[model samples]
Target: MPRDQILTFFSKYIESELGMIYSESNDFQLQNRLEEIVKLHNFANIGELYQSAQKGITGSLRQLVLDVATNNETSFFRDPKYFRAFENLIEKQIKGDLFSDKELRIWSAASSTGQEALSVAILIKELKQKYASDLSFSILGTDISERALEKAREAKYFQLEVQRGLTTPQMLKYFTKNDKDMWVASSELTKHIQYQKMNLKDAFYPHEGFHFIFCRNVLIYQSVESKIKILSKLESSLVDGGFLILGVGESLIGLKQDYETIMLDNAVVYRKKQKILKVA
Candidate 1:
């Protein structure tokens, strides 16, 4: 098949299957990725690759394409200031009368390999030790990749994954080094988090109403129309007065009208506006 035809075919397939949009300018990169898929699938050429993909031998091949096309580059505490602000927000929520119990529910919307969710759990544990409160919290981490979720379930990290945003003290307190010299998150920390596969484009929301949501960086890949739809759905999933934290570079501007942006000392977080009850 001609390069242009191959690019066009794959581009449309990706957009329809994964909600990914690629342009002709990305032809070289796309071709390289497709060539890798061809090798992996044992296709003789691009013609065979497309035919096999169309015939539904594309499940594994599709995952590879989505994994490569989507940017899943993430780190523990990728944004420090946002986390600091998160801690403060949790404390304030606990102190407020709005919530009768010390129950906090948080969701890491695109938790890739569980670092962000685990980090939040660790912070909660640390806070519990200091305050001596019987606080109940749940951290739910979801990603679209089954492979990534499997890694998250392992709760083990290579040297490189461990080096990011983890301090020596944290390493000592929350992790154990195996004989292989790899750092594994302590079972206690991993116990609080649950990892599941989720597609943000789908209408289904996590069952629980979230007190805090970290949907940072994932929206950049989505189209503006998709962004607005997803953000609106996310707002509905949040509790009244609940906080939504986005990537520093992301914004809700021209997206939704229900959330009010609050600038904290460390980060800017969005909160759903409280609805006032009118007396008859």
Candidate 2:
């Protein structure tokens, strides 16, 4: 059992390190996650781990802590309605000449294990077949967890993982079961995605002009101030009039200065205001 001091200190450290907040209500939860790491490292108690963290210990242990602390919960086509809105946006943009030769960039800002990004790729493949043969998509999947990104790059998943939001048609259409009895995304389906590590709090955002961004389900972990800042950066990175898809429950509320809410069947879609007038 971890002592009270250890839990308190650990929670604060996690908040500082990763910008994830854990309060006294979450002590048991924190203890549960920490205990696994504690046993893995063969530490006698949580105190030793605490000491190591305070000493600025850098290694697998710290990385594991941050990785586990993050909510890596994701699945293909997570919140199906968002994908519907996405499909609608794509159809709209392509008709406006946004699909002409130039790469259609979509950023899955916190793509856990790449399911969401791969889902987008699959949808694009379908769209390309019908609307524009030459339309090319460049999907970028960014996560703070290197471990998650590694799995994403691999694009392999167990039966249960793929079952979350994929239909039989989608499964048979886009993935193949491997020797290990796991389903792997087909090369054709994954051809356009590039996975990389990015921290939302960091000042430097490397790429921009994305036509669509699936920055979903990640902002709930951050404080309001952090959410505002992150949303601002995400907004700035998008091409003018590009769409930003947040998780189903997340909203700009008093926060959407440059975005307007567009309601879908069961989700909120934020579209960035256009920079200048273009004759229709």
How many residue-pair clashes does candidate 2 contain?
0
TM-score to native of every candidate shown: 0.91, 0.92
> What TM value does model 1 have?
0.91
Candidate-wise lDDT, in order: 0.82, 0.84
RMSD of each: 2.4, 2.8
List, residue by residue over 138-206, the lDDT tens digit for candidate 2.
999999887899999999999999899999998999999999999989999787989989988888775
TM-score of 2: 0.92
lDDT (Cα, tens digit) per residue for candidate 1, span 45-133: 88888877677636677787766666677888888999999888767655664455467888999898888988898887888778776
Total clashing pairs for each candidate: 0, 0
